[model samples]
Target: MLLPVRHSSCVLSIQFRAHSRFATTRTITTLASSAFAEIISRSSSKHQIYQSISSDPFVNLSIEQYLLQKTPEDSNVLFLYVNRPCVVVGRNQNPWLETNLKALQKHDTDIPRSGSSVRNVLYVRRHSGGGSVFHDEGNLNYSVICPRDVFTRDRHAEMVARALQKIGAVNAMVNERHDIVLAQQPKEFAKQKDATGIEDPFEESTPQALKVSGSAFKLTRNRALHHGTCLLDSPNINNLGAFLRSPARPYIHAKGVSSVRSPVGNVSAGLVSSAEPFSMQRTILSIMDEFSRLYGSGHEVRDCASRLNMTKSEFNAGDDWVAGAVGEVQLHEIPEIQNTFEMMKSTDFKFLQTPEFTFSTFTTEEDPRLRPPLPSFLPPLTRISIRAKKGIILEASISTSNDEAIAQKQALHSSEILADRTLHEIDAQAWRQIIDSIVGIDYDGQQQQQQPMEEVVDHLTEFLCEKFGV
Candidate 1:
């Protein structure tokens, strides 16, 4: 549906030189001498700006995809928005290996419960390849969508670094890996510059620098998108740490992008000025202006920067701009796009679509305190390995190498303990079914009634006992 026009008089057609070989004339409806005009310039190559009204992570991601697919070949696009608190995994990443499932379980427990319904932690996977990152209101996310001809990851990163610098981060710089880092100490800055010849203070070796932004990209035959998270005032860094920590399952092996752990700082920490601390709206406006300055044509910069200011509420409601000529803002309502969004939200698609990889579960060396005390009959330590494919157990083995005699004795003990190896397969299949069902439900537990953790654990134990004929 076309947006309702508020003021007919506000509509104006802006014309400029078209650069594309296929088109000689192009016109955009935008406010004269406004940011919208600059964004939709008649120039051969131009950019468009769209801000999502909803904060639903699923909806936001879907909107992103819609914009990318619908973008005009001659025009680039920019999206600025935040998502509800959730953990987004990269497309190729293994959910079991990249995230702390145990922590997620506890996280689910921490959510406030009402009646039989329980709020649950959300897990979203994106088409881009990057280590998992946490998202919330405090994290501002932006996406640069453009054709392959004009898409440059390094230039976009530099633009983001400049924008951060404009918002009170005087020392912000883009590192070799394209992360935005803040260098507080002179030594740290010097060490980083000398090492990589880049201004980044958060080089891999620089321990003092704190990363404020991390970027990733997705490319298509004709288009490309670079999106990233900017930490401004994350409410719970501890939750970020806990959820992003390596999984306790060490026996699993997969080829995936691993997150580079680094000290992170909130952009709000450096967002202060002589007059007052900068607000999120102000920060957003500053970034929009910078984006216009970098990507907009010379004929549009001054007018665009001067008029780029818009409050969060104004952007969300969009009564003024969408209907008028201030900008070309399109809210996606395509049924196909909506269906894709719903499919992506499903557990079957998210977990089962992953590349083939080995997953195992057993007591691993996680915390020293959690290690079981040494048994007198067995060696001081025993290592067990269980291999599985798509949740089906393939092999099981327990080993000890304290000494030859100890190894032989341990093998004998393992035979007794692992007498019913087939039981492991049956138990694994049952547990997989349970997890598959749980994840299929809505995160808030509204769509399905979830079994209590104690009940689930007891059920698994009972299944195992029956399998062993105990």
Candidate 2:
């Protein structure tokens, strides 16, 4: 109803006011974002907890290495996981020297030679330096990564022991060597736990003390990784013996690190004093809670419940697979991390990392699988000298005499398999004839190939038996 100019002026005024309000709102938002950025910059050293859901030992271990490598020097990370059955050896330790390869081969078959459905055991070598340790679903492994200056092995181990006690392992104590042991628990502890709805897994009558955990450490340029295994309620501990056997040969003189063997026990058998109750899920949560309380900042500690991610989507983008709650924990698996694991397990890669050493092959009599032991009257045979580099046998030679002969010397010198037939003479005539006959013996024109070194040895053993009339 007013003049055109007057109405236009009023409309312009309203528009200016609206724009001013919008500007003010944007300013406030900018200020809040700046403050949040400042807080993040100040606490860049915040501690983090990663709970992996993958049960594949290879995948879990690869993810651990990735996290340790990716974490900032100032930040601290705690990784927790349960791996399927596997044997993890130390970085510097020799696989053949530390474990029984033959026994391990038997464990690798999906179905045992006896046709049992027991799971195959996987072998892994960690970047840390320590003795070999067996891992299964019952074993809980924790790795703590932090700056070198902030790292305290004893304090970290004590932290684990205290958390263990909180979850009903009342008598859990860390030994000097950093192993957690259950000294002894009173029999009445079980009744108190049961009355209070707490779980005591081990039999009350079996009060024998056991080893609960073993730890190892690796210090890099600016950071340190402290990883250890905590035994939970593993059903099959008996299979541990099948893979962790004594050395194949006596007197292994190498500069490599050796494992100090000890009597190990499981945490399930440990003593629990609290009526608060116990469970694997509770134990895992408690350990993380204690870690956050001890190391995390005030807000960080309080927000742990929300920050803890148990889904694949939470950990990695584009990962939709969900590893549902096993027991009480909802686990997550990221397939992208598997590339690293596959690389780590590759034959050429792992084998090339082995240190150089002189090795002696096991004789027929020393073989555990053989029945009706070979007669001692047979010549001092089956003793072979091998010089290997990175686990690959570079030089091999047969030793007829009981005394140790160098591989180079034996290969150069003529050796006698029998009383009169020298190796040099046999190679010129008998060996050539055997090779020709073997080449001619093709299976349906599949083409006969050169026999493998191990099989060649077997053929030689049989040839000797025939020549000596054994």
Candidate 3:
């Protein structure tokens, strides 16, 4: 486990050893408090830039929140980070409706790497409000914290567009939706210029644009935070849709935001060149240069521009404005950040923070959309509906066409048991037990009725387990 560091001049380091096959042993060295203090004190600086060396999503997000809350009102800050495989949902979004929880639970060892290991994809709820997004080592996340008075939805997005253009992604531009997309180069325009002998990157073309970056935000009384993801060269790009497409979407009526599907492309796709291979480090440097130009002081701006060709490590080491892992460790020392970090990783915040939603096997008065066909194993005319708030079942009902008195009584009992229970807490075994108790079992522990009712119970148990990922 990662531990918080205290203020001291001595070097603080820890070795994390994991016996599980999913993780590898590694040594983590944290910077002393003085280095962290210098970075934090720069809140008053006209322009500040920091990058996280840690890939833990929780740690990076916690640090981002700290900067947003602690930075001076007039200061402009830039934070860059890369998280390991994880699905991040908006603050008000429902995880069950936005992500494939079952897929996330399955160990993913298919990511192309030197030494691939089984890894569980994480689910995170961000502090900002927007659609859900996927993050990985190849995806670079940029966040800008600026005064609310001067903040606009598209200002930083436009800045990122300029950065992409500077790096030879000439078709990159900010779309009306505030997302950065690479306009498709029409076949006719592939080899020819426009009427003025110049191509407009922002011009709307015929084919659909390929989105490369998604933007989201959080606005405070004085500070406005705009953060976005830039896809570079993710190995799992082809598998992104599977993880974001929730199995419960058809049955769920959610009260929160839903992700708008888009055809995504990588920024590296536009960086083809015979002389130089695609480099994420170079792309990040370009973005940092643009940010510095827009907000850095004269000397700082020049310094950033001069380091464009330097490696990321060299740039971080030589630049006084850049803080790396040290800043990440010191962030945990702040009470507010520590609390926010713990809260964000807690079960209550992950599941209970979800907005009210309903799951119905059939159409209802309130949610009258056409329903999908139920499993054939379910009894004819069988219907199930559950209403939940903050992940706790508020009301539930189950019924079948059967009019037998015992069946009616069992249905009512099952519904009663479902009500007031937490959706995600019900494991497959527990759910099976609940169904068995209602349907009745013989002395030999076999289901009493091995026909319609037994099949119904089996189907419900499987459905709940798969949908909730318990």
Leading candidate by TM-score? 3
Candidate 1, residues 10-66: lDDT per residue as tens digits? 213345546765533322233322222222333433445556555677777776776
Among all candidates shown, the one with the greatest lDDT:
3
Query: Of models 1 and 3, which has the larger TM-score?
Result: 3
Write the residue-wise lDDT of candidate 3 on 1-470 in tens digits: 22234432212222344776565433222234434544444544446667677687888898898888776788777888899889999999999999988877455645443234326888999999998998988789999999999999999999899888877777888988899977765652342222111111333332557678889999999999999999877656656766787878889998988787776767676553324677777777778778877875434433443433222221221123433432345545577767888999898999998999998888888889998887777666666678899999998766554545655666677778988998888878998888667655221234344365567678767876767665
Steric clash pairs (candidate 1): 19-44
Put the candidates in TM-score order, highest first.
3, 1, 2
List where candidate 3 sits over 4 angstroms from the true fold: 1-33, 37-43, 109-118, 186-206, 272-275, 299-328, 404-408, 441-455
**Model 3 residue 79 CA deviation in Å:** 0.4
Model 2 whole-model lDDT (C-alpha atoms): 0.53
lDDT of each: 0.55, 0.53, 0.71
* TM-score of every model versus the real structure: 0.65, 0.63, 0.80
Q: Give me the runs in candidate 2 sitting further than 4 Å from their true place.
A: 1-45, 105-117, 185-209, 246-251, 276-278, 299-311, 315-339, 361-382, 401-470
Lowest-lDDT window of 10 residues in candidate 3?
A: 191-200
lDDT of 1 at 64: 76
